[model samples]
Target: MRPYPSRSYQAIFWLVFGGALAYCVYGLIVGDLYFVGKSGRGAHLHGVPAWCFTAFVTFLGAGVWMREFSTISSRYRTRFEILFLVSGFSLLVLGWNYSP
Candidate 1:
């Protein structure tokens, strides 16, 4: 289905992208680059920085979701909205619970 010709989706997409980009910058400035650590077995491994990576992935994923979300059909609208809300809420909860 063709996407509706509206700028709202683009605005949202850019908003998310910009926020995530800002978070990455903040992470860098605030010394939150904990992307590597030792495991239980003492093996060094590179880990994903929770907040930074989450925001990064969300930024990337938002593009795809917004593309689908902007479509003219209503078939996936509710689902996308739910997904966006749930994912966003869950991220907030996770951040709150596991804040450093």
Candidate 2:
């Protein structure tokens, strides 16, 4: 495909995407203030349980892997990218619609 029309735009996208992935990854590990463990009170920002948030974060890992593969055009590892995109979307749904 064609390179980004603007290098700055691409840079911004990378920053945002990567940052989001990083945030979620870190959140999964840190959990939350009140939510200390499985028995603790897990908070829900938009409706998603903190545990589910962690699950969604795993998708970012896939996105990161795909980004590395795509950067070098290594064979057909594009599936990771697709997985990332789909997972990200699913995250939004869980975040917004999850009631329990």
Candidate 3:
């Protein structure tokens, strides 16, 4: 496979992908937020804020856009990039406001 013309694009792709994955793992390990334990009865886990869920979805979408940004055809590349930017910032803002 040919390399993307821009090294920076590749870097961005990996960064977003890795960041999203790490975030997921972190959430899981924390166990009180998004991750749930199967311990029987009275699992009084604090309800996660809606913004946290929104942020997670947006972050994943941004990662997808980053991964496909250079692979898609030119016609759709711009659209995807726009989606990526919008989602990325949406994720950021939602995350910033997120609280258990």
- Candidate 3: residue 9 Cα off by (Å): 8.0
**Per-prediction TM-score, please?**
0.44, 0.43, 0.43
Q: lDDT per residue, candidate 2, 1-100, as tens digits? A: 5452467755776777677666665665666413334775664342245555655656765666466524646445576677776886687567657665
Q: Can you tell me which runs of candidate 2 are displaced by over 4 Å?
A: 1-48, 69-75
Top TM-score: which candidate number? 1
User: What does candidate 3's lDDT look like per residue over 47-97, in tens digits?
Assistant: 344345535555556646555645666657667767766776766566556
The model with the greater lDDT, 1 or 3, is 3
Worst 10 residues of 3 by lDDT: 42-51
Question: Model 3, stretches more than 4 Å misplaced?
Answer: 1-16, 32-69
Question: Per-model C-alpha lDDT, please?
Answer: 0.55, 0.59, 0.57
What is model 1's C-alpha RMSD?
Answer: 10.1
lDDT of 1 at 66: 56
**Model 1: per-residue Cα lDDT over 1-100, one tens digit each:** 4635457866887787777667666655675643334654332112234563555456446635654545534656656766765675666465545533
